[model samples]
Target: MSFLTVIASASLLAATGSDSIPRPAPSGPLVAPVALAVPFRAPVDTTKRARKAVTYSDGYYKRVAIHQALSWAMLPLFATSYVSGDQLLDKGDDAPDWAQTMHPIAATGSAVLFGANAVTGTWNLWEGRKDPNGRKRRLLHSALFIAASGGFAYAGSIADQAEENGAIRERHRNVAIASMSASTASWLIMLIGN
Candidate 1:
């Protein structure tokens, strides 16, 4: 036999504990196979893993729908506030300085929230329909919408307080509370559901 062939045979027999190779002594206690981490375990049952992933995806889509609906609901309210502010101020040729200033402020807050909602909602929808970009898009849009909604409500509340209108102040306060609750819920759902 060639020298290379003899060496290969010797190594193979040594690896298999043949008489040609001495075996090493055990130096540690024996242990059972480790329980794999969650991701690794999933591969053991491909179908189940696929189902769970699909469920997560579907729930994400539902959240997207909810985000869209909430955005739509906000739009009309924002439109009303913005137009009412403008119309009220426009009625007087020499509007009071405070009314003139407050109207624009109110309208501006309304517009900011509505615009932010739209931008975020659209991004979220696009993300949901696509795979590679879904997670990042969803997180970003959810955050943006929450900020927009919360900021707008807070601004509206401040405006109401500025006017010294008790009923308006209370109404705005309630609205702000509701907006905060929704934002919190949306984020929680996104994290848990996904």
Candidate 2:
């Protein structure tokens, strides 16, 4: 997938980044999700765990496990941000003062979550680059994530500016939505590939 595919997912693309490649849902009992990768490396290829060559480092695995745990912990924060933000975006004008007050806080919450993703994500990606493996889907997924980070950052920075100017507000909302949507696509691609 190209970076354009990620950015354009706001309207122009579907799963796998482009409409050209349709992503059909798997039909059957729900399968397990991708086990999070090790913080600075990949885990034992559990699909091949029976092979002696694939082994896990307890210390490193634990470290990776912590990052993974934190990543999961972020979902609620992001969800809270999204829900509150929508409340603010729609019917914000007549909403109670408390609702207006909470909007920025919610956005901050999501930004905090994004911070975790940005830090650990880039760190892991840098480590992934040592090998030739990120050349395909990993490369695409990582690139899109970086782009999404920029989008969220821009949106977060302009929240105040948005309230004052119609143009700024529109831009803020657009980028924020696009960023989250694209980031989700990137995540799914990597997850399913794993």
Candidate 3:
């Protein structure tokens, strides 16, 4: 008798045979069709995959911290050595007592600092030789520092000669300055890199 009832009757008649009778409609509201709904799925497991492990030696971080601190300490020592050495060169025996005393003291301090750094750095470098990260930078820094060390050693060997000969004194000063410059450059590379 109504529009929905007629439509329901037509659907029921179509589903059944021509001779079959139509069923009565329910008294509730109409429900929407669910034919287009997607089926449910479980998440895939990722924990079973294989992976490579990378590790560092014991005390690696501690050694790195100490190396960095010693590097920072080198700045003041370098400045003191340079100033005192310059005064000693310009004034010869007339140089101030403090300058004369501070020169060797600062030089010794720098040498000790470099020695400690070299040991720690070389050890760490060898330990991490397999690591691919920053390999080039580390190698360059080590090379520069090694060259500086040799320059400092040569200058020290000529110290006695430098005291007696003006020419040797100038060469000693030049070598020391060059070594200091190389060390400074190496220090800067690490500082900027990190």
Query: For model 2, which pairs clash?
Result: none
Assess the local accuracy of residue 40 in candidate 3 as a C-alpha lDDT between 0 and 100: 65
TM-scores of all predicted structures:
0.33, 0.59, 0.72
| Global lDDT scores for all candidate models | 0.55, 0.67, 0.88
Q: Whole-model lDDT for model 2 versus the true structure?
A: 0.67
Question: RMSD for each model, in Å, please?
Answer: 12.0, 27.2, 9.2
lDDT of 2 by residue, 85-179 (tens): 66667765775676677767766766776677667666665555544543478688778878888998899789888777878877888898888
- Among all windows of 10 consecutive residues in model 2, the one with the lowest summed lDDT is 48-57
Candidate 2 stretches with Cα past 4 Å from truth are 1-60, 73-75, 133-135
Per lDDT, the best of the predicted structures is 3
Error of 2 at 193 (Å): 2.2
Q: Which prediction has more favorable TM-score, 2 or 3?
A: 3
Where does candidate 3 stray beyond 4 Å?
Answer: 1-53
The sequence of per-residue lDDT tens digits that candidate 3 reaches over residues 55-154 is 9966888899999999999999989999999999999999999999999999889889999999999989988788777778999999999999999889
Q: What is the TM-score of candidate 3?
A: 0.72
Ranking by lDDT: 3, 2, 1
RMSD of 2: 27.2
Model 1 lDDT tens row, 4-110: 55566668887887785643444555344467776535355565433223223565566567655654465455544545554443454364565566656555655
